[model samples]
Target: MRTEFDFAPLYRSSIGFDRVFNLLNNAQRLHAIDNWPPYDIVKTGEDDYRITMAVAGFAEGELDVTQERNVLVVKGGRADKQEGEYLHRGIGSQSFERRFELADHVKVETAKLANGLLSIALRREIPEAMKPRQIAISSGLSDQTAPLQIEAEKQVA
Candidate 1:
């Protein structure tokens, strides 16, 4: 059974959070995705993250990772034909694709495949212009610093 959530209440109070609500709605509606390959998302640092996936039968050359807008996509497949017949195939050699939603300013740093595991690194880099800055406040009436002067003596100096 699937349950639907109403976001109308949150829309009126929240500002600039439409993307987050949209992602939540889409996740609840999507039900056809397969869980063949297991994965894990971990936060390694304050602004850094890592995604590790198990790809036992896949190699580095068979996997593809891409980032479009705020979404990261990972796909893996193998075209090599198996010559021998298997009585019971349970290694999960089928092709699979997985997508991850990234927040603003989040970027992929690197990807490494080792010991049948694929690990992807991510970091959030906020721009200098967007960072918080301190403003200097002047209480003394200096002619050079102040725009307008109330006394003529201060302006002449």
Candidate 2:
């Protein structure tokens, strides 16, 4: 049995949240995708993250990691020269593409492949203008000097 969600009602009720709805729809679509060459996502710091993928048998030249806007794409492929026939093909030897959704201001800092593992580091740097800041609040008009009355400044002429 398959279940599907109807977002029409939400679309009609909510305004200025198109991005949120789109993200939800994209997440639902990602659930049915293939999980090959297992990977892990870790939060290393408050705004730092790391993604590691088990990429055995894949050389550094055969893997490509790219960040486009708010999406991270990792692709792996082998030319398949057919070195030999495997009695039991346990390890994945097929091309794969993986995508990760990133929030605004998130960026890929570094990527390295070693010991059959591919690791990518990410950090989120919010702009100074976008970051929360303390605003000066006035308790009341008492905080400022009262305006000088025009009549008081003028003498009987």
lDDT tens digits, residue span 2-103, model 1: 789999999999999999999999898888668868999999999999999999979888999999999999999999687898899878888989999999
lDDT of 2 by residue, 61-112 (tens): 9999999999999999998787798788787889999999899999999999
CA RMSD per model (angstroms): 4.8, 3.2
Best by lDDT: 1
TM-score of every candidate relative to the true structure: 0.82, 0.85
Poorest 10 consecutive residues by lDDT, candidate 2? 147-156
Global local distance difference test of model 2: 0.91
Residue 91 in model 2: lDDT: 77
Question: In model 2, which runs have C-alpha deviations exceeding 4 angstroms?
Answer: 141-144, 148-157
